[model samples]
Target: MTMTVVPAPAETGHSVAPPGRNRRVRQHWGATPYLFLLPALTLLGVFFVWPAVTAVQLAFYDYRVVSPAEFVGLGNFSHMLGDDRFYTALTNSGLFLIGMLPILVVIPLLLAVLVNLPLRGIKVFRLVYYLPVVTSMVAVAIAWNYVYHQRGILNWLLNTLGLLDQPVQYLLDPGWALPALVLVESWKSLGYYMMIYLAGLQSVPRELYEAAAVDGAGPWRRLSSITVPMLRPYIAVVMVLAALDSMQVFTSVFVMTQGGPQDGTLTLGYYIYDAAFRHFNMGYASAMGLVLWAILVVFSLVSYRLTRGKAAAR
Candidate 1:
């Protein structure tokens, strides 16, 4: 006997995941980012946000270690208005802003351009440049003491080059101390800024530089046109960071100068530390901190304005 034949049902092009699995996947996508961000958010709140709030509260109160906190009602700020040391610290911070701006922003970009060249041993040059970035500031400061000594390498070099009539006590001279600190700060951080600019440089298309060269454009022209325009975002970022760090300079000052040599290198940051810990003036220190925060905001705004341009961004 002949058996009846039947055709199987046609298969659909797509497989339908189970409803439970689909729901689970959607839930995972929604929750995963928040889960990843939870730790960082917690840390930020604990460290930065909480401290900021506490500082604001302390700014309005006279909180000393010896007694209970008393409400001051801006007395600390009014006192800050008359503090001579405060003005001196402000002036020193401004000088740092000026001295480090070019050294940190412009010079690093130029150096990055040089090191970005396709040449032998370029990686070695990058490493050498970046070594100082990883070096501890305390160690660097200690080493620089010898460098600034009367019979030190720096003095010898200056004398040999006829730049100095004699070995001037760099960190000891009131007129020279601030500038010397500026130099040290710049040298310590130059490598880090260079790496930033170098990263930006490498991200730029090789074809642009080659095309510019083919059209008889010089290195300077190509850099001014292609490199600058493309690296606008990086420039803005670097400028803000440089301004913030320069204004908040403390470690080098604390380690090397202790804001001494007639308080020539007394930056606002060091002064804040001094007021808070050394003199037990928490309210005053908090007030000064708020002022410094305002200054940082202003500086960041100015830096962004200076570097404002349409960037061929990453």
Candidate 2:
């Protein structure tokens, strides 16, 4: 007897595709990795993207804590222009960048190069150099505070070295305060940047240096041609990081001087804190915070773009 093949009847509600036709469905189901990424995408949208959009919205309005946001339409931007405090913070921040950038960049690069040499106990030196990077910023700030105080270690050393007529109150003097803070920041930041440069330096091939030496290239020539060019990406990273950190400097200034000595050390970061907590001008403080963020964004973008151009050129 011969058996006949039978086809199943259609579903009551939904229509089922033929077996070969369901390949597209199976292909879609195979896209599980992207589905897994949906959670992270949602998180980024909620945290970073949402907050950024909100910040931009907040920038436009003169918002009050109790009252609804009053749409001021560039009023905050105009107000910031006439704000002497804003100008002061801008100036101080600029000065800080000027003072700290060179030291932070050059010293770290130099240190990295030196430590990367085939010398004895270089690992120990690397560890010693990196200690400050891991050390607590608060503890470092407090330690420096005492050291910078009148009759403290710094003053005592100055006096011992016969460099000062008296124990100068480093934080109290308007002229000295900002520089002092910059020095402290530089000291705290150097180790981290140095480590970064060290990592970058390690990737540089040894053959290049040997070839440079073979060609009668001196130390300066080798550094200028080989070391400097090779480290451009790292330099870019260091500069952008340093710029962002220096631009928003607050904690040390807040704890040490509280933007003291005639507001000499009054930075945008400090001003934002003051307007919010001290003066309770949430709208103005938010405006300033947004402005600070704008500055950071602009600087970072510019630096990144330029770095990309240089990298492309190479």
Candidate 3:
């Protein structure tokens, strides 16, 4: 005699997922992040992308806010060749680019090195240095206005130190106005770039410096051989940022100088603002904006290449 077995029946209320159900669930989860990003993308398109497109279109028109836009093709761009103020603005921007490089790049590196040392109260010093970076540019400009005054703290210190025999007005004088703005801009930006360099410094291996010291390397020698080489990538970043910031110098010129004293401090950014708002030359201003944008693109590309080449060489 033989015994036979029987199969068990399916569960009463349990449902089985259909084929590809797990894949469908995974696809739904993959789309979840894009749903979260939708709000930010919408705002960016509405605010930035739309305005940029409008500006580019306006660059080809002759629109004065009160008048209807007339298609002018490249007329607005051509007009820039005959505009003295345009050239002046370009010159001022060039000066800012030159003036900010050393101050923003070298000084910030030095400050980062100093702050990175294992000294007591170093964190306090770092906080003090970085305070200006978080402060509003408007407030910084207002505060510096006093420092740049004819009889202000800067003049008094210079006088006491015998550096100046008489108080000279900085923002009032056409010759000194642009330079004064450069100083203020550089000062405000230094702390920001310093923190960047500080981050890079902290990432560097401490063993290299220790080994160099064991071999009797001095501070300057160690910095030149080890620290500088290590911080090169950071320097490239700072250089790009500084170049972009310098070319777009505006707030200080607006608040402190108003691009005044015979347009001495008239940077491309300030001029663009003036043409659009003050003079109501929206089309011309938009054209200038496009030109400035092109310049920035080219400048950034060149700078990045140079820095990358140097880093590779080293």
Candidate 4:
């Protein structure tokens, strides 16, 4: 017996939909993921967006905790122009950025190179270098306080080496206070930047170094030509991060000098804190905060552009 196969009836110029089409459509445009994201979005708006709006609004008003807010409309910003302390803070913050750049950007690269060596137990060295990053800033300040003491080991060594006529109080000296805090901040953060560079270093091709070596390139030559070029992106990241950290140096200053020794260690971050909490000038503090934010944003953009332009040129 022969069986004949027949085709099913077809619609006129229209295809029939599969039973699973609606299910697939629902899955493609599902609202479940968005529903899950709503909580985090709500929290972000409450914590970050709300506070940012409040700060901008408060910058236009004079609000001491004891008095009702009076709309001053750029008065706080205008006051910043004539404020000597504001200028001092800005100058000190700039010095910090300068002092920290080498420590964070250059030294860390060397450190990453050292730790990237294939020696036995090299991981131990990396961990040792990174320990300070996880340490509490307050604790580091306290320990550094001992080190900066007149009779401390550092002073003793300095005296032994004839670097100073007598023991000097580092934190209490106007000339040394900012530099001392800079050292503390750099020491604390060096490990973080080193780790960043280490990651970049690891990603670099070993074959490049081998090729350079075959061409009779020395260690320094290979580093300058290969490692540095390859690490440019990481260096850019480090520069921006270091600039931000240096500008906002507050904890060490607060714990060690309290922006004192004749305000030598005064920084934008410290000044903002003092204006907000100590002096209760909330509007002025907010204005200064905005200024600091603007400076950081501009600096970051410029640095990023320069780095990217250099990379592209190469």
Error of 1 at 7 (Å): 16
lDDT of 4 by residue, 1-314 (tens): 99977655463455678879988989877978988899999999999999999998999999988999999998999999999999999999999999998899999999999999899999999999899999999999999999999899899999899997989998888988888888999999989999999999988989999999999999999899999989888888888889988888999988999999888888999999999999999999999999998998998897889778867876
Q: Write one digit per residue (lDDT tens) for candidate 3, span 69-157.
A: 99999999999999999999999899999999999999999999999999999999999999999999999999999999998999999
Clashes of each: 0, 0, 0, 0
lDDT of 2 by residue, 1-314 (tens): 99976655553455777898799789888897889999999999999999778767777887766778888888888898999988999899988888888889899999999898999999899888888778887888899999998979998998889998888998999989999999988998888999999999989999999999999999989999999999998898888888888998888888898998899999999998897788766677778888888899999897889789878887
Candidates arranged by TM-score, highest first: 3, 4, 1, 2
- Winner on lDDT between 1 and 3 is 3
Candidate 1's TM-score reads 0.85
The clash number for model 3 is 0
The segments of candidate 3 whose C-alpha lies over 4 angstroms from its true place after superposition are 1-9, 12-14, 20-27, 303-314
Q: How far off is model 4, as Cα RMSD?
A: 3.8
lDDT on C-alpha atoms for all candidate structures: 0.91, 0.88, 0.93, 0.92
Once fitted onto the true fold, the runs of candidate 1 whose alpha carbons sit more than 4 angstroms away are 1-39, 302-314
Candidate with maximal lDDT: 3
- Top-TM-score candidate index: 3
Please give, for residues 1-314, the per-residue lDDT of candidate 1 as tens digits. 99976544435355677899999999989999999999999999999999999999999999887988999898999999999999999999999999998899998999899899889999999899899999999999999989999999998999899998988898999998999999999998999999899999878999998999999999899989999988888888888898888999999999889998999999999999999999998988999999999998997787666666434234
Q: In the order shown, what is each candidate's alpha-carbon RMSD?
A: 4.3, 5.4, 2.8, 3.8
